[model samples]
Target: MEIRARGARRPYRSYRTLIAAACAALLGVLLTPAGAQGAPRGPHGAVKVSQPVYSYADSVRESVWVDTGLDGDADGVSDRVVADIIRPAEPARQGRKIPVIMDASPYYSCCGRGNESQRKTYDADGTPLSFPLHYDNYFVPRGYAFVAVDLAGTSRSDGCADVGGPSDVRSAKAVVDWLNGRGRAYTTRTGTTRVQAGWTNGRTGMIGKSYDGTIANGVAATGVRGLETIVPISAISSWYDYYFQQGAPLQGSGPDWLANYVESPAARARCQVVQRRLVDEAPRTGDVTALWEARDYVKNAGRVTASVFAVHGTQDLNVRTKHLGQWWDALADAGVERKIWLSQTGHVDPFDFRRAEWVDALHRWFDHYLLGYDNGIERAPMADIERAPGQWSTDRVWPPRGTDTTTLRPAQGPVAGVGTLGRTAARPGTTATFTDDPRLDEEDWAETADLNTPDKSGFVTRPLSHDLRLSGSSTVTVTATPSTETAHLSAVLVDLGPDTIRDYNAPGEGITTLTERTCWGPSTPTDSSCYRETAPRTADVTHTVLSRGWADLGTYASASHGRPLTPGTRYTLTIDLAATDHVVPAGHRLALIVAGTDRGLIQPPSTTPTLTLDLARTSAHLPLVGGARAFTRATTGAAPTDPAAGRSRPDGVAEPRRTPPIPGESG
Candidate 1:
């Protein structure tokens, strides 16, 4: 094994050959238990497994092609399929046929394919965009053909890329057939025609992000034998739960815009111009259309045959953390031996050097499965990523699979105080109460959200005397009922007192800060201007919380499971603390704000789907181990000061304002 320090870049042409040679000498073909690898069928019915040919900065030509129909009698078919094949751009030292690696670009043409990313997405270095873009690039040089196809109707492909995974599976198969079929001579690299490898042992795999990552689930569902392993980054396990939780869209209009971009008419039209569209576009408005529903990998997640190394970001606003929950459940039930990692990184990490870390991991993954080289990846933690204060940790399984479950009940105390953890008194039935009229004011936004102060919550403050690491997405199941048919809920975790909250909020004023409360000073109890943010989140915030916009669930009246907290009656409200990793200085206390609204990120409730917290049926679930790591808030050993200036939201002089109730609510 070559030992190199961090950030060291060496030419791989020679190193790859060396690694291959070393691998060949040490391990021929490791023995495996029967059925564990399933029945193997190679190219043309014979199994032939050979070492992969890795590429180190080789000549690569980016071209587009039109795929003619292979089967004509299938009701309807796409005109042409577009593909992006990366072979050894120039001649290689080894004589090998193209071992094509085909990947599906799920929803490649969303919104409007017409104006895809501009500039052909070339980097400043003038090199065409490359893969290993997010994960590790170290492995690609090891003799693997990388093919990213734009399916039938998306991008440069021929037909359509429906929003569904089934269509995506078909799109993938089409490319797989093309690469190994008669077209082998068409895709040439250097001086030799490229052919599929792994046919020796039938080991082929795919790696991708977001929509692309989802194709692994679809392909696996088909029970296809050619697939070997998959690396699903920021993957969505179940579209239903991803887009909607508890029947209502957990996310708001944010993702709809993105989905439209993936399958929009404009992108479709552009495919016509470039002949890049893939599968035929599915008819919209049909409840039965595969795209409309059933995108959830969770439903059939148990059937996946491919070994998938699932990685996701704790702060991934696009796909969120729940994807991990659902996918893990499916894989576990199916008894699939898998590794899960939760990252603090953003979605799929397509751009920037931050993605470089994934390279180290990918090299290890491919080396183990594709080349049969064990590089110690199997012994790595199931969940691994940077932890609080820039440190990192790993667990055997997600949620550690063995961490003790603890209940954190909210009780009464000053929102800000030189306080204690949990609650002051630990009685069996502990509770905290605060009065929230239909009106209150929020002048600050939580940095926790991808949107400016996306979290919908309210807070009161006390001082924090010590720093704390508040990490991991949490669950708060409180029995709450609104006298009115509908209301919204916003829960926040804040650092209160002099230094903590001030220190945390000051970041909002960063040179030119965002969000309403910080941008615009806090307003009157009834003023909505202070609540609106320049960049709002996706959830509907209108009625219950004084959000920038409104989403009404309607007052369904009673929550069948819980009692209604009479407008004047004593009732319990629950708050889900946004995960954080900040240091609270000696003079500050972490403030946990439980409120009804914070525009953008979240808001109260509406009818048709009013919320009810069952006090009798309440609990809070926090995955304490190996999740999002809290930060070192007091690393500087100093307190934070107030913002020099604050920005406010646009105020309509004529709009009526609502006021939050003071601590007193009259019966």
Candidate 2:
């Protein structure tokens, strides 16, 4: 939709003002008396106060090795993941327990974390000198202990990096078990000196971005105790969805590549066997094997007792929107208490895009869940969505309350090239044919909407008379006859109009880092809460592809099985596009592009194939905010003279970059 610039969007001065206000408000609440806010009692039945009376610089810093009970590297000894902890010393000295915030990550030593790529640092004696990101600096003095964990096989942890498998998940779960007194911990990796997490109140919260966040999701799904909540930003719900799409490989590399990338140098030789096992077990066929099931957190959502504060970029191509869509749906079905923030940026953290709001919301969420504070955060809106750049809105629940399915079918247009999209179905025998072209991708299909391309079929509706909002995932079902035994198909939903949008293709993926620094909390000589400021990067574009889906025709009947298609037989295939919440502005048309081999995004098929679609049975079922009536009211009008009507190629438009196996060094 054509959203007007919201008061000089993302101005530096405004950010400073907002952050100051939020911090002041938070400080005021924290300084309030314990019983004044009607806060709940702690596990020990003692009334707790949400105040930052402790000193950040004087926080205790130490490390402990938690036994994972797994021999991932076939070593004689059980694997013990390392946990580097920092907590207010006063709490322990006074025998006052505090809640814990843990971040279990494989990238702490290899790829680092956050916008600045801060890695964990240690003192000469092996005690942690600094924990990456601002979590420790910001929350440690605020009555919370922050733990930085080295996932098994990475950093100081012992074992093989199994990528997203049992080793990866259980290693982190072990730390939670130890904190709750269910597992054992040692002062040293090999020493017999037992250690206890006695300072903790046995309540914990996990938070992180990307892979770090992914581990939190996995651990929470294990039904582990003491993990009271999780804040997973741009995290994966399923490793299968991360590497593949509907039996179609999205990237050439598998779990083995990622495992090798994050394995510690000390364990390289020992981890080779585990790496080989990963490659052998994870077949490139994109089948749902036992290895994938072990990593599929969505299927195990029922086991999650931890309240989730999920954050994801709607346009995130790395850990695609499907991960969040499926996981969120599953969480809802399981009756899990959840909240989400959907940003317009790509593979980005809210800390970069909406820093002030993110920090404030997170503080409240943690206080409510982990610290037993009745701050009314659960009573707030369930969703905070950035509908447009720098413009946010909230809803009681995601996909909006009145959302319903609206099916739009393609019918033959008067001319030969493009088709008309409307409520009425095409005639029984109507058909559209297109041959597979490995060179063209979703970008090519979207840009050449007015042209008749040999590789794709375009269907467009009349310009909308009013804005039509689409709130959730969409399914594109096609009954097609293929000329080959196996082929690939891609469907993309596009907004055909001129508008200014976040430049997701930019260097920072929709954000430009500024030289100005903003500190969130108290800093030490070795570590600081200060970080470079950022503003949304914008681009004027003729069209924006809202959602895209790809699938293998060989697995048309089921995602797990692949059956050869008869040359002349008609088969129905369902391609589930990623979820989105977007509004097609008035005077803009909604278009659907059905194509083959979305290069770069999906692995190309072995052979090219021509497919003919039975237009009568082919339709796009979308979750429209107001359903069919809303769609009709918006689209029923004399077509406006589309600014892009005669353009054969769009300007300032680019396809979503295929995120590499390693999202980025700064992830």
TM-score of each: 0.57, 0.89
lDDT (Cα, 0-100) at 161 in candidate 2: 89
lDDT of 2 at 134: 78
Against the true structure, candidate 2 reaches a TM-score of: 0.89
User: Any idea what lDDT model 2 has?
Assistant: 0.80
Residues 535-622 of candidate 1: C-alpha lDDT, one tens digit per residue: 1111212111111111122212222122223342333433334332232334544433444543333322442222333323344444
Q: State each model's C-alpha RMSD to the native.
A: 17.7, 8.3
Q: Which candidate comes out best when scored by TM-score? A: 2
10 residues in a row with least lDDT, candidate 2:
1-10
Cα lDDT listed for each candidate: 0.39, 0.80
lDDT of 2 by residue, 116-146 (tens): 7678888888989878877897789888999
* Model 1: how far residue 43 lies from native, Å: 32
